[model samples]
Target: MTPASPTPPDASRRSRGSIRKTACCLHRGYPVDQLARQCDFLEVAYIMLNGDAPDEASYQTFRETITRHTLVHEQIARMCSGFRRDSHPMALMCALVGALAAFYHDVLDVENPQHRALAATRLLSKMPTIAAMSYKYTIEQPAAYPRNDLSYAGNFLQMLFAIPAEKYVLNPVIEQAMNQILVLHADHGQCASTTTVRAAGSSGANLFACVAAGLASLWGPMHGGANESSMRMLEEIESVDQVPAFLRQAKRDPQAFRRLGFGNSRYRHRDPRADILRETSHRVLAEVGMSDRLLQVAMALEDVALTDPYFVDNGLSPSVDFYTAVILKAMNLPSSMFAVVTAVGRTVGWVAHWNEMHQAPLTIYRPRQIYVGEGYRDYVSRRGERSAELR
Candidate 1:
């Protein structure tokens, strides 16, 4: 994996097939490696996934574009208004995403090129709104509408907590950290969720339908649920003192907690993004004055696991999930909200990929497989007795 050499847009467009993988990150292009070196991950995602690198103006425009879509729909907000304040944020998030599918039914019903572009724009814009609204609803707060004038990061912060008394003053460090996280997590080529998006899109399902398919894939514990599970592991340790032993036990029997985070992919020995996120988590924890003993334990566990041979043998590295919990918790967000935040940032990449697919004229994907079962069988009527040999 290396930084992408400068190539003409047409050349790059044609280069896609040389890179696409059905299930792994692009089997050919190293978008993550290229992104990790130069541009912020968000911008790289827009380019690599969307197929065009946005200039400064375009970047600002899309930033504003996403912000403009962050407002909660009046009807959806009303529906959620009646739910218990203590209900999990993910529950509200799920409903909000589904409601959005209904709210944009007009676009869903239209299939023309212009209509597809419009729907793409609408979905890209509105995802953050739905995610932010879910958080506000969980807290039973009056949802703050999107302020068009704010930068994407600023606007998202405002939507999450809008009142002046407890206003979110954007910090450069935290904003950069969040942007990095978005960048790193944006598009792992043909990840389970991305594949879901492509599969549904291939069927000519509407944009929302495709997004919902991706969301369902993300809901699986083996995928997006890893972040939530990682945090839970931290909670289980409870203190720095508990970390070494936990790692030893985990090392002692890797399969015992194979279900946990830090050891699934066959890529890097450690997820490359973890180092940056671990630093960001430390900075955030220090800045926010959050010193959960659990966080300390998480850090210690990270150290032992990184050095341990068993983890190294398994290609187990601290993934994005390992640090997301700490970062979100430090930001005062509950565990349930992390996945939605992940979705909000990711929708940009999803639309970009969808748009790219539309341009290339892809047919509905249908792969063939070998059938190993008996090739011929006789049909038996209810009134007829089957021969013992046939049975």
Candidate 2:
């Protein structure tokens, strides 16, 4: 008998697994690290959406457009007030954004460029306000309204830190650091949250609902909450001296150890964002005149992990989450607020990807999976007969 022909390669599997070209490059095709060093969040957002850096006239218009939409409807604020004070900020944000569809159905037209633009601007502007409102609601503080006179980052800082009967000055260092964080996180190609956004948008869903889906996906610990987990891990370590023991424990049972921010799935080398954030974290911490033991432990842990043979061999390195926890902590933001901050920055990326998907010729996203299970068999209604068949 002739030998059986070799099995044909699974083209579907290969195609599904293959890496595609990335289209989220910053202005002039600069890398994110370089872009983070040069541009603020608004400029970066403009570049991501428009495929070019904005000129002076366009930049002013873009900034003004976003500023105009910073205030949400009074009903949305009342809706946020209904959530329990202890509710997770991200959960509140997801609900609020989803509810945006109910209030702004006129701008849900994906086929209309003007409607899409307005929707994007509204989301980008109001997300920070919504995030800050969530925080104030959780702490039972009266919501501090947005100040359009301030820069975007400055306005967010005011909303978060300003309170009645006190003038809160925006520190230049903190404002710059916050802007850098937002710009660096503005877009990463097909990240979990972005993929979620795209998948939802594939159904021709309203922009607000699609973005709300992305926010929900980002609430997972493995994604946007990495910084919060990383902060918690650092706090647990408590001191630099304990980092060695922590590392040893991690080596033994990684699953139980929960190394939150040391590695990234897509970045094999040091994450470009981490480098910029490290510098910014140090600068901000020093400027604030803060000396945090947890920050020290985090730094030492990163140092040891980078030098350890096991981590080096396994391609594990500091990711953006590593230093971001420290930076946010230095800014006096609670660990609970970390993911909300991430969502605030990532909203632009979600909007950009949603627009891209809507404008493309792509159909609805329906991924196939390989089934490795028992073949079809007769259904036995009786439990006794089913058990006997199994035996």
Candidate 3:
């Protein structure tokens, strides 16, 4: 009876149990339930990997530290000028993430708890700078320096679009929208890329090396790649009238329609998060006066799909990505940059999870497999073995 497939293990026994024991990256004993909602990506990240939310003082200090490091070091700024404008932002993002390793090689080498804490601090501090610089260079703009007084989201906004010719005024709505998206994407129990980060970090690898591995995993289309897919789907439909026909085709042949942005995950019927993002999309779309045919089409499709029995039974719904793409697109970001935005928000969680694994009574991740190959044959002399094998 296959040994009755072993009983579910306790969270406290993660170190002793086989890797297949857990369903996802979530450490069962950790306070994942408290964190999966209510916290922003940064806060949840700190909680998961660090085992506690930052107290007011720590939160303030960490926020300040991150703000201080939000602009690229001048050397990185110079190097970025080398890439062509048409290059994909992810290529530049990967290079920049790796470049950070060079900047803090000494910090990474420190093994003391205090020193490791500083390394974590530096990484959290520098992420926005690295992400912002990548965006600026890809668009051929002089990097906007980070402002000390602005909120974390505000500073990222400035770095992305502020120009020498004009002062960049921060908009409250846009910043809130960005923060919401970041919070929603903070971490997913044990996602593929996050698992990659943990596996790489397991050997006591430095944070940069681990984060690079995570970024590579995020580059897969089924994961972060869906952000671009969401935008493209909206564009393909192009207007409200097309929504019904598209819905009909999709319903009649789900294989043919596939509902690009709407149906990807376990929370079928409608993502609670989608309602929030949809509001933001509307606000941004109206702000930008973008009355594109695609927007109308997407809205129409959403209306039908939300009411459709097909989607309800299937446990599929428009995800956070669907609304997020429209909001970002309205804010003037290219689809290529969508996943990078996801990566930036996710870095906080990634680093935190890496830290969490370190504090755990450490286990090297090794999954087991049943042996299924043919039984081994006895060794023999080359020619003798060949003749005897047939018999």
Q: Identify the candidate with maximal lDDT.
A: 2
Model 1 clash count equals 2
Evaluated against the true structure, the overall lDDT of model 1 is 0.67
Measured against the true structure, the TM-scores of the candidates, in listed sequence, are 0.81, 0.89, 0.82
| Cα-based lDDT for every prediction | 0.67, 0.81, 0.69
TM-score of model 3 (CA atoms): 0.82
Candidate 2 residue lDDT tens string, 1-391: 3454498623211111112133123333656776788877888888778777889999999999999899999899999767888999998999999999899888988878899988998999999999999999998898999998998888998999999989989999999899888877776666788888878887788899999999999999888998899988888886788889888888887543435887665655566677788889889978976567877787798788779998766656667887888889989899999999989988887787777765655477766556798998766755657744776
Query: Which should have the higher lDDT, number 1 or number 3?
Result: 3
Model 3 residue runs over 4 Å out of place are 1-55, 252-259, 369-391
Compose the digit string of candidate 1's lDDT tens values, residues 1-391: 3545496433213224213232234312554544544565445645754466789987776665555665656887788777788876666665666667787777764347777766777776666667777788777677777778765555666788776467567786667666666766666555777777876787677787788777777767677777777778778876787777787787667754655767545454555566667777888878877567767777777777777777767766676687877788777777777777777766756666666667765567654556788877777657675554367
Give the least accurate 10-residue stretch of model 1, judged by summed lDDT: 11-20
Clashes of 2: 0
Q: What is the C-alpha RMSD of each candidate to the true structure, in Å?
A: 6.4, 5.3, 5.3
Clashes of each: 2, 0, 8
Q: Which ten residues in a row have the lowest lDDT in candidate 3?
A: 16-25
What is the full ranking by lDDT, best candidate first?
2, 3, 1
Error of 2 at 280 (Å): 0.7
Which candidate should be chosen as best, given TM-score against the real structure? 2
